[model samples]
Target: MNKYGRQSGPRYSASTNSAKAPATQQCQKCLEFGHYTYECKAERVYKARPTRTQQLKKPLKRVEVEVPEEFLPKREGLAAKILKDKEAERKKNKDKKKKRSRRRYSTACTHMQAELRYFIAVVVQQWKQQEQQEQQRIFTQLLFRILALSLRLSFSFAFALLLEVVVRIPFSLLLEISVALSLVQKQEQKCEQR
Candidate 1:
């Protein structure tokens, strides 16, 4: 069975196989058949033949012809004059280019300077703001530390005072009681002697 689940055999129709076909392959250029147009020798020879324009472009041997005196211009320094005019024109163009470039460069430089100034101002402002914020943070931390220390000191002092009162009050009362008992014993001994 094939992929579509049908029995596989010859798939072409009989009519297609029975159709008339060419007896020989013909070249499109020469129409002479064993090869295609690209391989035809006659087409290559025809392409290699030079056209009329190429034949005319071949250089002719030089032959000088004398110009009549009446047809020639009377100016003796025409070539020097042409050279001077060309040099002046070139200088003018060079000067104009230099001036234009200078103008553009100056404008660009001024704009860049202004931009740099604005950027520096912005950066300085940001730095100052950050510094102020840092100072405030440090101040707040110091203030908190000072308040905590004071609270701790006050608590420690109160605890020490309380501890002293708790210990000293009982000790003072015990000393007074012992002193009073010794004085009463001495008086009793005196009365017996009498």
Candidate 2:
């Protein structure tokens, strides 16, 4: 301890001075570290980047393979003929599917047509029923009117005839007694009595 009551070691320690490194500047033109583009005095350093094609490419490793020819491969049924037969079978399956689709479509059309026909028939039946009901109502109204007219006409005729008979009985007798020449006369001509 010093007389100032301060205990001290190396004040400027090497660790304290070397705590951080100097910040580096990169050159924009050369893309190299350690110097800015404006302060760069050395030649521009170019990074070696491998040239790549615009599209993706892969290296093909090929090796020459020697094959011994088999004479049995020249038979009638080759791999190509088998592939052709498989393609023909696929075409036949496709045709069968098309036929099934056609049959389903036709059945659907028939069903729709049947439904339409049934709907039309129902509509027609309803229309006919309504028409018949309307006709029946009109006929009943006409019949009722006819019956009422006939009853009214009969009542008017009976009342008029009774009044005539009652009025002419006395008058006819008086007239026959006064005249004493003519036979009995019928009712009034103005009333159209026949």
Q: Count the clashes in each prediction.
A: 0, 0
* TM, every model: 0.29, 0.27
Worst 10-residue lDDT window for candidate 2 reads 181-190
Candidate 1 backbone overlaps, count: 0
lDDT of 2 by residue, 99-145 (tens): 99767756764664455344334434444465465654443343233
| Candidate 1 global lDDT | 0.51
Candidate 2: residue 127 Cα off by (Å)? 2.3
Whole-model lDDT values for every prediction: 0.51, 0.47
Put down candidate 1 lDDT per residue, 125-171, tens digits, no spaces: 44446546565444334333322322222233323323332332235
- Residue 63 lDDT, candidate 1, scale 0-100: 100
Score candidate 2 by lDDT: 0.47
The numbered model that scores best in lDDT is: 1
lDDT, residue 66, model 2:
70
For every candidate in turn, the CA RMSD to the true structure comes to 41.1, 34.7
